[model samples]
Each structure stands twice: as structure tokens, then as C-alpha cells.
Target: MSMTLALRRSIQTTPEQTATVFHGRRQSFCRFGDRVARLASALRTQGMGSGDRVGMLGVNSDRWLEVMMGVWWGGGVLNPVNTRWSGPEIVYSLDDSDTGILLVDDHFLHQVEGIRTTARRPPLLIHVGEQAVPEGMLSLEALMAASAPMDDAHRAGSDLACILYTGGTTGFPKGVMHSHGTLWAIGIQRLAQTPMPGGSVALHVAPLFHMGGMGRALVQFIAGETHVLLSSFDAREVMQTIERERVSDLLLVPTMLQALITHPEFDCFDLSSLRRMVYGTSPIAEAVLERALDLLPHVAFTHSYGLTELGSATTNPPHNHGAQGRASGLSRSAGRANAGLAVKVVNGDGVELPRGEVGELVVAGPNLMLGYWNKPQETAQALRGGWLYTGDGAHMDGDGYVFIVDRLKDMIVSGGENVYSAEVENVIARHPGVMSCAVIGVPHPQWGEAVHAVVVRKPGAALEAPDLHAHCKAFIAGYKCPKSIEFREALPLSAAGKVLKRELRAPHWAGQSRQVG
Candidate 1:
């Protein structure tokens, strides 16, 4: 019913058990619960009332978990800002959600001034970093130390818990709202499908801001498992942590898995403790999957498929990655729908398509998001007739396995991040170089898909790739910037005068098995 219930249960049953490990700092369940309560008390003292919004801008750390639970405990909704975004993007999300109290770490101190100057209503700043607190910001450590521990607010069942921002087709990010009930339902569904082992130690390398990372963390908490935190993903650091902490579970994108398996000293680490590995965000290459299976024969692999709006919809179980499943071509599919969830491929007219027919994937489940915050029309478009119309081109076989063939939305998944082509194109169009552009994803060896832009320059103006790249970096995140740019006199267009993105992406993905990465 409520996420905080998990914390209370752990405190009652296993108060002495280790709950969190980060950079040599470990906290038991009892200590963690007390800190969370204190932080919640501090938030309440800072004018955060029930249903108020609080934003956090930081990487993965023990404090991140505390802030998340503390907000819920204090009856506030969480808005976890994307660290990779530029100042304007972050400001848009915070301002859109009307977040009043913003948490910052040392890594993002430089952006505080810009946020204060640009945000419609500047928020109160709280420092949650290891470094010394900034002059004007309140220190989280000081607040927790000074405030008295408070009781949980007991907000549960349809109470708004989080507003997660996802890349939007309208050249901005949209806040996807998820209630406590929806999130709790998804966690239970995942557990029912693949139960975690007792005394499991989960390693957190994925960014906590994204759904994939946050959902996995929530499941670990629901199961009362220990967590090993990492500030960010570094190949060597991840391997070292796995060996040192004896990590039993992990979630990764195919790109991270590739980097881990191909590390020069990968075999030197004693990764025998690792028992389960769940990968998603993008399909894995056949070669990469085979290599990982050969190297970690003891590990069970699962591929999870879902969106921000619909939390874990389907999961390709461990057996599907084995020899028999591979021979049957099941390894290439995204697996069946999760328990209590319904999935089907529907045509453009909202009619369900027959099996083996590629169409847009639609899902109906309790895990579906409440709606996009403050955007009624968009929400209506996404959720209609009791099904969330996922903009993914896929098909279901007779056995109910879903195989994603392409993306119906003009979005690209690169290195586990969603990059909307419209967002990138908007930034490029602002350049004085005066041009029209189309952005698409190209086949990439490591990133799975790389952002590629095709542009037609103004007749008299001379714009180069380097200049455009620098221009884009000034306005958008580095990962969304084009990895390659092509200049042309004219771009291929359709009868409707829309630029043909499929034509732009065709040559690059000539022989790939799937159009999507």
C-alpha cells in the first residue's frame, strides 16, 4: 500500500541488518530509519506541507535513498532532476512541477546561481554533499542532526509519490506522475515474477533519477535487501565494487554490460557472488549476450521492457537466455507481459492486431502512471480506453513473446538515455547558421544507438559540423548532441512535406537485425 511500510517492516524485523553501504559508510536498518524520520522532520520545518513538491539534483548515493523516503514520509512528492541536463532543462522541470525546496550536491554547485536567476520562483537550497556546505545553502547533515525524529505521515494508496521527467516530442520534457499505489503494484509484480534471494546485496550503478534505476531500488527495499551505492558508473569502479562488496544482484543497460565483460582485468575479480543480472533500456546485441553468458555462467539474466508511464510491463526470464531458449530464438524477444498486466499490439485505429503483426504495443495494468502532470491533452492521448498506448513498434508471437522491431515515436535510446529528435532539432534550428535539420539514431557499437543529424544549410551561410556541435553543447546535454552530422542540399521528404527520418536512418542501419538498438 505504501513504500514507507517496507522501511517500517525492516526496522521491526531486522533492525541490526546492514541497509546501505556507500564509500566505507554503512548504516543499519534502525539507523537508516531514524535518519529518514529526522530528514522528514526537517522538511516539514522548512515549510514543506502535505502534497508539496521537493526536488533532488544528485547522483546515486546513500543520501539519495534517504531523501526519496523522507519526502514520502513527510507527505511530499519527489521530483528527481536529471543531472545530465543543462541548467535550463533542470529549471524547466523544477518550475513546471513548482518544486519549492531543491537539494543540491557538490557536483552541481555551479548551476545553483543559474537556477536562482532563471527559475520563476527560486527554491530554498539544501546541500546534500560530502564537501563543506555552501554559504547560503542549509546543510542536510546539520538539519538531520538538529531536528527531532518524526513519525511517518502514512501517505499511501493513490497519493502522488513522484513526478519523473521523460524526454518529450514537443521539444521539452514532460513530468510523468506515478502514485504510491502504482509504484507499489509494479514492485510486487516484479517480485512475483523474479523473487530476490534472501540476504541479497544489490549494487546501484544506474542513475537514480531514471525509472529503471529507481524502480529497481524500490524493489530491493520492498524485499528488505541491502544496497551498495555508487556515485556513477565507471567500468573499473563497478568491477571493484562487485568483488569487494560481494554484490548478489545488479541492473544494467546492454552498453554497461558490454563494458564490464570486456574490461581488461574482468577475469581477475571474484564476481562469484553475483547471482542475477537484469538488463533493459535497449536490446542487447546477440554477440554481447553470448559473450556475457560464457563469462558468467552462474548468473541469471533477464531483459525488462517498459516505459516511464508503465513500469515493468514485461520481463524475459533467466531461462530465456539459456541454450534452449536461444535455439528457439526466444532470447531475441522482450518476453511476455508481467503478472496482472495485459499487453497487445494495436493498429493505429486502436484495434488489436493479430499475432505476428507488427504494431504499436499497448499495455493495460495497475502499474500505469496516473498521468502527465498538468498536461491533460497529452495524458488523454497516451492513456485511452484503459490502455497505455506505448509508441513502440512491436509484435507478439503465438507464444505471447513481444519482439520490438522499431520505435514509432521520434525518440532514440542511446546509452540508456532517451533522446527525443525534436528536442535536438529545436536546439539546432536556433543556430544562426539558418538551416533545417532532422535528428535520428544510428547504429553504434557501444552505445547501441548514437545521435545522428542530417542538415540542409542556408544557401549563403557556411556552417560546419564542429561549429554546430559546439552550438548544441551550449543548449542541450552532451549525450543528446549529434555524434555525426551530415550536410546536404536537400533532405528526403514525404508527400506531406515532412522530412523522412526513416530514409536518413536507412543506410546506417542497413544490415542490423532490428531497427532499434
Candidate 2:
């Protein structure tokens, strides 16, 4: 079934129920459906065609969700831009996807000029913020008001839904494409694993551009629950929203969870309304988990594990976080495969490994992405023999619990964002003073892992950390830039002359039980 089916059902069954809450604004299912229809009509009038790609570059808000549904309602594809990326990076995605219409918020107005100058064909700009409409750009409200409500296009099954960009090992980002069928499968699998309570209200803290955030939002919509949105993650604001809205559900990463539970005025707010939380994208520190379990004894905690290529393959239920499960060490597992999904560890030759033997994790399910956009070779490498190679080194116990040990790919998860080491190293190696460099993820207190760089300087060159920092800032996002830098005369290398990143990362992860945070 198409995702729009959820909205259609909500409008038919509970038109007066609250659909979205953003800041002080609230919209009922009836009103929300009307706005979505109008927006879809506006998009069609603006020349959006069936299967065309439309991009939304903004923070999380009611309008963001509206645009997402409207695009599909109008029979168009969605390409949600990464809010943290630099101008060039954003341009690359827009150009790569051939997005013809782009929506911008107040927070991203500064990027418009860069996009216009650099993009192959600059998209038609529509201002979605509360600020005064910019010259030569159309106002979203005006367009919606001018257009009449339109019918749902009923796009479903193999029809493309979204193109989500993920960091690449080739110093570029690749677009991961998903169809309506795949997304519908993910929602069904999630619901079958852990059902949402009736009248559950979910507060979104993670960016809507992320799979973790968007995937959970899909599940909530499928369950016909109320949504409360925050433009970004703010500990105090999250606490206030939960208390005021009586939010019962949340989807947060380890970093956001830590910030919320460790806030100075954490106890000042009445957060008793929250009942269930799902955390993923990075491993949680044992100390933080213990503290949270103690502080929020009534809340059920679940851990999820998945990737953009394959949405939500496994979910550790709340029972695994309790005292009994902790004593049995089940808390460390990423849980078994969700309903209708299959996960297995395999050797290098695609042969299944024995249970308890560490190997690459592969998943097979209806939730697997169609493929990477415009990259047939990469898609083949990722999806082979009806299985998606996850690039995660893991082992499954006899009971089917999967434990992640390391990343087979040169990638890092810091503050719930994926950073490719090759992408960062590419930016650093561009510095004329740097002879060689390697990027690795180091243990971090707040971000779970931090991007760290080790550089070998050119003889007689005065390359400092500040110089490299400034250089990287020009090409990549701030989070992808190195949090710390160290200089060495020579880097440890193998016989093949490849830098041994394991040695460099070992010092920083000395006491960590696993290579990943």
C-alpha cells in the first residue's frame, strides 16, 4: 500500500483528531488533509510531473511533513536535503537527483545563492518559512491558498517514494532509493514487532531527513497517531513539549537521549507522560543506559538496528533493557530480525558463517531499498543473492540475537550522523601542506564517536591543525570535519602502503569493549 493510504484512512475515520502539533500551531486530520491536497495542487500547477523529484531543504516542522505527503500526493518523488551539509554538497545532491522544485526555510535562506550559482539547473524556489517572501521566489502559503484541493494520485507499490542521500566511500554521497512497497514493508515490520498504543503521541527530536526520524514518522502515520515536532534537538525544549503535549512516544539516538536525561532542569518538567522510546543509529554507553533506566523506570526502552539501504531490520524490545535481560547480557544485542525479515552472518565469499562467529551481516526482506539512484554497480555490490550486505561486522547467537562488533566499511557514526572516513580524508588530503592523512572515529563522551584525523606533514612544511581545519571547512560539513588532529612524521602503513587505521584508532578506544561506540 502507498503511504498516502494512512492519511486517507485517518481523514475518513478520525477527521477531527489532532494530526500535527508544531510550536503553538495545531492541525486536525481534516485540516491537515485539506492543506496537503492544496499543496499537492499547488505543486502540480508549478509544473511538477509524475515521477519527478522535488527537494525540501529545511528543519523539522509541520510544513516539512506537509511537503513530504504533498509530493507523494501529487505523484512526485521526495528528496529531503541534509540540513547540515555545505552549499556544494547540497548542490551536488540537487544536481544528481535532477530536482526541479526546491523548498527552503528561513534557516537555509543563505544557501539559495550558492545553489543557484552552482546547480546544473537551479530548482524553482518556494519559501516555506514565516519570513517575508524573497524576491523571485514564490510563497508556499500563497500558492496553497490560490490552488484548490486535489485528489490523491494513489501512487503505490513499485512506484518510487524517496531518494535519501548517504555518505559514500568514494568521497561523494550516494542516493538510496526506496519505493512505496519497501517503505510500507518497513512500517508493517515495525508495527508487528512492537505495536503502538492507541492515541500515542510521538515527539520528534531527530532531523526528519534522517532514516531514523523519517522511518519512525512513517510508523506513527501508519498507526494513525498524533505527531509533535521540534525544528531541532534542544533538551529543555524536548522536556517542555513532552509535558505540555503529553507525548507518549519518542525516537532518539544515544546522544540526544543523553542530553535530555542529563539536562540540568531535567527533573523540573513532568515527563511522566512518556511511555515508549526507541534509540538507534549508534551504540549507547553502558553508564548512560543504566542511569536512564533508573531515572525513567516507567518508560519502556527499545533499541533498533538498521541502515538506509534496509530500513529497520531488527529491534530489541523493552524487555531486553530490564534487569533480567541485562544480567543475561541480552542488552548488548541489537535484537533479532523483525517480523518477515531475515538476518545472517556471512564470510567473505557470501557463505553463511557458524552461529557465534563474527562476519559481515546481511539482511533479506521486503524492506530492502530498490537500489542506489543512477549507480547500477554500487547497487549490485550492495544487493546480491536476494540479500543486502549491511557492511556491519556482527555475530548472531544461537538464540538469534545479533551483536555488532565493528564496521566493515570505513564509516563512523557521530551524534547519529554517518561520516565516511574516505570523504573526510579526501578533504584533508587536498591541503598542499599535508603529505598523507587518515581519518578514524574516536571515542567521545557526548557524540558516541568523534571524527579524528592523523596527518603526516610534508618536510619543512608548517601545517598546523588550524590550517587543516580551515581547509576541511571549505568542502565538508562541520560534523564531518575532524574534532581533533594529530601530526606525525610518518604514518604506520601495511606492506601494500595502505595506512593501518586500526592502530591509530586503538589508542583512543583502549578501554572500549567494542570497536564501535
The true-structure Cα RMSD of candidate 2 reads 1.0
lDDT of each residue in 1-517, candidate 2, tens digit only: 8999999999999999999999999999999999999999999999999999999999999999999999999999999999999999999999999999999999999999889888999999999989999887899999999999999999999999999999998898999999999999988888888788699999987899988889888998899989999999899999999999999999889998999889999999999999998888986898888889899999999888999887798889999999999999998789999999999999999999999999999999999999999989999999999999999999999999999999999899998999999999999999999999999999888888889999999898989999999999999999999999999989999999988999998888887866342
TM-score of each: 0.99, 0.99
lDDT of each: 0.92, 0.93
Per-residue lDDT tens digits of candidate 1, residues 1-517? 9999999999999999999999999999999999999999999999899999999999899999999999999999999999999999999999999999999988899999999899999999999988989888999999988999999999999999999999999898999999999989988988877788798999999999999899998899899989899999988899899999999999998999999999999988899999999999875788999999899999999889989897788889999999999999898889899999999999999999999999999999999999999989889999999999889999999989999999999888999999999999999999888479999998888888889999889888889999999999988899999999999999899999999888888898898877343
Q: Which pairs in model 2 have colliding backbones? A: none
